[model samples]
Target: MAYVITSSCIGKKVGECAQVCPVDCIQEGEEMFFIDPDVCIDCGACEAVCPEAAIYPEEEVPEDEKRFIQLNRDFFHRD
Candidate 1:
């Protein structure tokens, strides 16, 4: 995964990120938005516009907030 939407977005998903995403890889969820890792092209446009500052590149994700990486994956891949 490249960018992960963290807890900061839990209740503040404004959808601007989705609009800016060239690939339309960001999906709205009950709790937050999940970026489809496979669909995302890593363009970083969404990250630049997120008002909540909830998006982070995988390598730059804070250590404690890393769980969102899996959260994003499971959002689309859950059984």
Candidate 2:
């Protein structure tokens, strides 16, 4: 499953995750960074380097932060 970037990263586009992402799936947003699920390799590299602890597997994201899974998708799919 793809990794999701949660609210903890909303205002912190620190980009440590992006820097370590081998597939370059992470993209900068106005307020944060979003993982392109379509491009993600599910390698977990981004999650390992996130200092904010904001990255989680899509299925493992905490209940309270699950909205981020959709948010990440929306960020890339918005028309």
Index of the highest-lDDT prediction: 2
lDDT of 1 by residue, 1-79 (tens): 5789999999888999999999888999997899988888888999999999999998899999999999898888988
Instruction: Show pairs that collide, candidate 1.
Output: none
Give lDDT: candidate 2, residue 10.
85
RMSD of each: 0.9, 0.8
For model 1 the TM-score comes to 0.95
lDDT of 1 at 7: 93
- Judged by whole-model lDDT over C-alpha atoms, candidate 2 comes out at 0.92
TM-score of each: 0.95, 0.94
The deviation in Å at residue 6 for candidate 1 is 0.3
**Candidate 2 segments whose C-alpha is farther than 4 A from its true place:** none
| Residue 16 CA displacement from its true place in model 1, Å | 0.4
